[model samples]
Target: MNYNQPTDVLLIDDDVVNNFIAETLIKRASKHTNITVCLNGRDAIEKLLSIKQESGKLPEFIFLDLAMPVMDGWKFLDEYHRLNIGDGSNSEIIILSSSVFRRDIDRALKHSVVKEYISKPLNIELIRKVLKIDHHTN
Candidate 1:
């Protein structure tokens, strides 16, 4: 864990607009942040596996959406746990889904990788307050 290294954040969502918004907010929160956006869970899984293979470095944080076309967040989590590529502790996963169902929230909370669950339309405030990023700077 090199504090000097730029923090990497991965966003797994199908919505291009949401990705853009999340990316923008993340950049504002921390200029040093490096964000990777995947359209679906499958793509995200492939990207993560590639990262693991090449650099052996996983993203510091992941913002996951439950609803997707190819592979949803639930299936992704199942595979994520099965693959065991992530150290579980290094990459902190936060569910950023639009679903407000208690069942959905409960299921996500049960997952070991998931640290927190947030409602969609991500904002800078949640990034700072909930995640405690607080606009990190050099």
Candidate 2:
């Protein structure tokens, strides 16, 4: 990876263990990036908004959990798109939930800011796949 290329990522989950595991996997998948985790959607939104306000350096990607307390992924997506993060470059949100229900998937697909959906227990391969997909799409 190019040292100059930014690989910052944001993870939002209520479970601490899940957050740690996801962050660790991301780090293992790519050594040249910075990863930040938020315990819930509300916190993640605040942090992201602050980043935009302070440094204008929002994370390139956001791994979001749907069934979180305080604020859920759907609410986050609503607020996120309302911000109008144009060009979709501020951050790309990927739903990282254990939910496999078709209704949940359908709802995720309806959101413009939601780039993709990922399952729990993130792995290096999945991270790589995300990178590749984003690279290709972008």
Find the candidate with the highest TM-score and give its number: 1
TM-scores of all candidate predictions against the true structure: 0.92, 0.87
Model 1's alpha-carbon lDDT is 0.88
Off by over 4 Å in 2: 1-4, 85-90, 133-138
Which sections of candidate 1 miss by over 4 Å?
Answer: 1-3, 135-138
Displacement of the residue 127 alpha carbon in candidate 1, Å: 0.9
Worst 10 residues of 1 by lDDT: 129-138
lDDT (Cα, tens digit) per residue for candidate 2, span 98-124: 999999999998887788898777887
- Cα RMSD, each candidate: 2.0, 3.6
